[model samples]
Target: MLDIAKLARQMPEIGQQMQKDAQASVKRLEMAQQLFFQANEHQDNLIKAQELWCDRLIFSPGTPVESLDTAIDIPEAPPSHSVFSSDGSQIAPSHHEIIYCYLINIGRIMLHYGQNLHPLLDSIPEIYYKTEDLYGSRKWGIRTEEWMGYQRTLKEIQILTEMACTWVNPPGAHFNVPNLAMTDGSLAFWFLDTLPTEAREEILNPVIESWEQLRESKIPIVGYISASRSTEAISFLRLMACPYDVPNCNNYCSLDNEKNPCQKVEPLRDSSLWQKILQPRQRSAIFRSNSRILDFYPESQKTHFCYLHGGAEVARIEFPQWIAEDSELLNQALSITLTQIDKGFGYPVALAEAHNLAVVKGGDRTQFFSLIEDQMLRYGVRNVGVSYKEARKRGSIA
Candidate 1:
């Protein structure tokens, strides 16, 4: 339980810290706004900023960045189109539960949009409890919640890939209609960055394979991130603030714990950078992600992103380079995304439905454990017991 009184006692200190932070943030915002208007003047600075961090591999330079002040109109949607989106939820391995099993539910939706909406497909939940499913004994020594979440993400991508393949090569009639495939978050697999090289490969191999299949199937795939705080693009502005040349800055920026000279834009986020430029129903220019993890993905599958402003906050939408390079494909993707947002009254309805189908509520988790206990008893296993704390909580009266 939380110590509310103790937390209350610290409120004064917390408030002071918050005020300091807010002041620093205000300074950063002022710097960003100044750069926003003078973006054309600092075009070369953005490029040099990327070059300075090029070796570090944390920055991906955006193209036509001189057009940062401009906003592109929302693209037109195809008359008839199909949209597929996938989302997943998982029940992490629990110590309090009788069984050591964990569950993952992946929800998929295929919606056809034209004159009116039509649900062409539904959600499918797949639960795995076998020893092989619970643990990654081959690579990981222990089963962890992080590993489970990674597996859940892999399944989500795999399902989206499978659906993309199926839709493109329908058993009877090919899906000639413009179709798009999307997942709920960033396409980059940043979660594996700290894992051992071999473990990262083991976890990402299937995901990469699925992505290859999806790309080969020619179905545009994108990852939708709402309220993104990514600063990849804004980091470019820091280069403009650098007092030295790009090469000199590179020399000064080293892995040997040298302080970066261009830390003036410390608190700026990408959405904030574009918020000053983009209007509702408009999108910013696409910029390729220079994430170090992109090295794991094939060159063709490198992710790129752009900021889109709906009636609400700026959203970052990531897609493979192939989709971004082709104008028609990019427009179709943008159109479908806007349509989804409109349908859901600000977000994608398909993803919303997929999340709804995949979410595992607290009550559902309780019933799941109860079912496990019942099955164990039915199998003549009587030693199963809940911890004392769990029992107390179960029996506690308000």
Candidate 2:
């Protein structure tokens, strides 16, 4: 427990420092806003700079697909539409546990508006304990926890894709309404960038296949990030502010020197920029992600994103290149997202419900381990025990 008296003694100093930081932040925001307009005015030059320095830049700058300064008003919501979302939670394999195993629980939700269709909510739990499942391929060298995270994301998208497919072609009948499929985070396979070609293919192949299925079904899918601190847009603005004609950061810019022209609008995020630019329910222009992992993705699956002012905060919404290029589909997706946020009170209802279902609480973890131990005992293997470190954590100590 914290000592209130000790904390109170330091509160004055902390408060003073916080005030100073707040003032500095305000100054940065003003300069950032100015730089933002300047970047917009010189948008063509900035785009040219990106083209020239594409291979040399250290940061991932977004490539604008539309006018850089434009903010489109939210499109009218459809009278009847469906939104499907899936989220997942995992109990990563732990060495301190009685058994080396993990559990993945996926929560899926489907909500139809103006159609009188009953909403669907379900959760699926799966366990991985086999040697092949736990360790994965020896060549990959990825930790079990990290591998499980990737697998969980894949399962979420796969399940969401399956849900959309079923809705699109349900039992000899075709239901045609504006449908949107959403996941909780980025769709990019960025984590696979460090892995070998074989490992990347092993992971990305299925994800791309799922994306293709959604595309074939003509269902628009998106990855929604709430209160995002991503700086891809800010990085683009920084590039626009670069003094070098060629803008070669490796040769020209130095982090040790605080005099870099691009550092003028330092310590700002994409969301902070959008919060100043976008009105409620409006969305910024779409920008293509420059993540290196996209080199492995097909043209159709390349990731694109835009910032949306969804009432409470700026949100980063990402989708595939195909969806971004299709104006009608993009508008439908934006409409669904804004409407859902309004209904859910600043968050999407489908995603909120899915998260509620996916979360594994403290009690759930305890019960999970107890069940494993119970099964081991049932098999007459009574030697099952947690690691000493885990046992100490559970017991009281003076």
Candidate 3:
């Protein structure tokens, strides 16, 4: 159905554009690298850069905070400990299918490392199919896809929190050991950025409640980013180079390069900068995030992150500010995280297994739809069928 001839004609132009972009990128990269090395070597300058970021960096209306610029060495992991991870996969609402429903499957894994590898617990998939969950009505007050996606994110946080609580206070056994609870990505609820104030609050309130439950459980939970391109560190450099102290400085700073001391590192990612400095199993200083989303988070749940090297590429590991304030818990979190990364060869083993458990195969969906059709027939609604577009996709072989 595609126009191959037209595509072929455009290929040469596309290739030329890509080449030009690549060359420009290389030039900027070299400049960023030079600035990174220069800043890393000069402790006095690094300190100054941090101060400027704290004092003048343009943060969201209500989010103005200081930075924690102390880089602690990676502590050794204990010989025996437990690590738990959770991941979720979703089946989005389909317009082509006879059934208009979505499903979210969360897979959780708890692994204990002592004399040998031991699996402690694994959870069965949780399914929801109530009247409120299946339909998109004016009464629901939100679009079907938006509501379903938001539910999936909320479920992930809730599941992680529930698992952490269960581990801390089991019905049969009691153990007083330090363990780490982790999810696959950043803890910040990114969905809020796309919603209106009231709609955002509806989702955010419950998510924050779940976070509070996890915090009260006193278990260290981390959001692991294997390969990060965040510019939080570079933002510090920009603040150091900022020309004016006024709230709105973009108009003046862009042209006043002479006054901007941090201009050389204007556009650099934190991971790229750390890749040059951190050794295997090393972690950079923990820094508080000035992300606008933090303004909505409860005071106890504000997020902070650190750059780490776990025998692979540099990554960003994020946690709540509460964890960072506690020395013992922070060390435990850093140590266990490094252990998981080493075991999985740069990725966390628990998260990998969780993903594997949560994945929904194509065959599974086909079988599931077939079962739904059978149920419909039993209910005397046999005439319901997939859309014509879906039927055409399954054309006869002969």
TM-score leader: 2
lDDT by residue for model 1 over 1-398, one digit each (tens)? 79899889999999999999988887888888786566556676566656656665333435443256667898768789888988989887777778777888888888886736557555565656786776654456535677777778888988888877876787796458888887889998877777788778877999889888877777888899998878877765655666665534435655454346666666578887778778888998777787778878887788888998876778999998777778788788888898888889999898899998888899988888888889899999998988788889899995
The true-versus-predicted C-alpha distance at residue 73 of model 1, in Å, is 0.9
TM-score of each: 0.87, 0.95, 0.82
What does candidate 1 score in Cα RMSD to the true structure?
3.3
lDDT of each: 0.77, 0.89, 0.73
RMSD of 2: 1.8
Error of 2 at 247 (Å): 1.3
Candidate 2 lDDT over 177-277, as tens digits, reads: 99899888888878889988887787899999999999998999999999887888888888767877788988987767766778776677889889999
Alpha-carbon RMSD to native, per candidate = 3.3, 1.8, 4.5
Supply the TM-score for candidate 1: 0.87
In model 3, residue pairs whose N, Cα or C atoms come closer than 3 Å (at least 3 residues apart or on different chains), thus clashing, are none
Off by over 4 Å in 2: 255-259
With candidate 2 superimposed using the best TM-score fit, by how many Å does residue 216's alpha carbon deviate from the native?
0.6
Q: Where in model 3 is the C-alpha error above 4 Å?
A: 1-30, 33-71, 115-123, 126-131, 135-142, 244-247, 250-267, 396-398
